[model samples]
Target: MSTALLVIDMLNRYEHDDAGALAESVGESVPNIRRLLDAARQQDSTVVYVNDNHGEWTADRRELADWALQGSRPDLVEPILPSPDVPLLVKARHSAFYATQLDYFLRTHNVDRIVLTGQVTEQCILYSALDAYVRHFDVAVPSDAVAHIHKDLSDAALAMMERNMRARVCLTDELVGVFGSR
Candidate 1:
């Protein structure tokens, strides 16, 4: 079963401080997510940046990046994920599947399993993962690769994924172990 990485809400508006709305929540997971993304790229796996439109119809990604760099958003997304060259950017409001071509992309790519990793585990990630699962796609989330405002929320989100959605809520170290047999 092939897997696609759904990076939800790792956008400039959320991660970057300039966009400012308490989204400064995501921490160190940036590098961890980058590592997994790089691995997916190397393996020829799909890397979908499922981000929020921030309801900015006229918002240019470049403008957002510049504003983020201007120091308004200390923790804003850097050049790592939100790049203009990445042809796989899907903008959304709540769920990544909300009016986004994400489901189409997954179907087109023949992806059955989805590896979810991003910010606000209780909100965006939670909804996206559940949506994917409800659509009959396999879902897995690396515990450390997801960051919430609090650990309890993160844990609860993972619990919902495991209990309700039947997703594999794993830690980074356990991922290799879980995938190594294949």
Candidate 2:
């Protein structure tokens, strides 16, 4: 399957109101996300960093990384920072496809399936999965790779995606095998 791994909102500086809480929650998921990234690289799957631009329209990947490194938890951004060759799409909204070239980019690369990973599982992950489903791209969300601000909402969101969007609500190891298979 032609697949892409979308890493969302992990480049955050944690400067918002719920930044600390969100950071702490997402911290546990970082290692899982890193595992997914490493597997994606080994499998030759497309790795895209779809980050929230943090309202800095002029900011590029380097600028965003620099800003994030100065935040309370620089370690959060260190492990998962996109390499220079990896495509980084700066999004202004929650859904990565909203007003962004993500759809076209995926199509251009012939990506029919997407593995979603990153922070705020109830927000960006949920919305992005909906958008991906409506756009006809198969969605796979590893439960352990996504961080959430709210437990109840996160569980509800995952259920909604699995039941409604038909997303594969599996674990990171399972997804790694799938991505690595022919």
Model 2 scores a C-alpha lDDT of 0.91
Residue range 10-94, candidate 1, lDDT tens digits: 6554433332333544555776677776777667676677766566666566654554455444454673555554544547566
- What lDDT does the true structure give each of the candidates? 0.70, 0.91
Model 2 C-alpha lDDT per residue in residues 1-182, reported as the tens digit of each score = 78899999898778888887788888889999999899889988899999998889999989999988888888898999999999999998999899899999999988899999997899999999999999999999999999998889999999999999999999898888666543
RMSD of 2: 1.0
Q: List candidate 2 stretches off by more than 4 Å.
A: none
TM-score of 2: 0.97
Taking every candidate in turn, the Cα RMSD to the unseen true structure, in Å, is: 3.5, 1.0
What TM-score would each prediction reach against the true structure?
0.82, 0.97
CA displacement after TM-score superposition, residue 115 of candidate 1 (Å) = 0.8
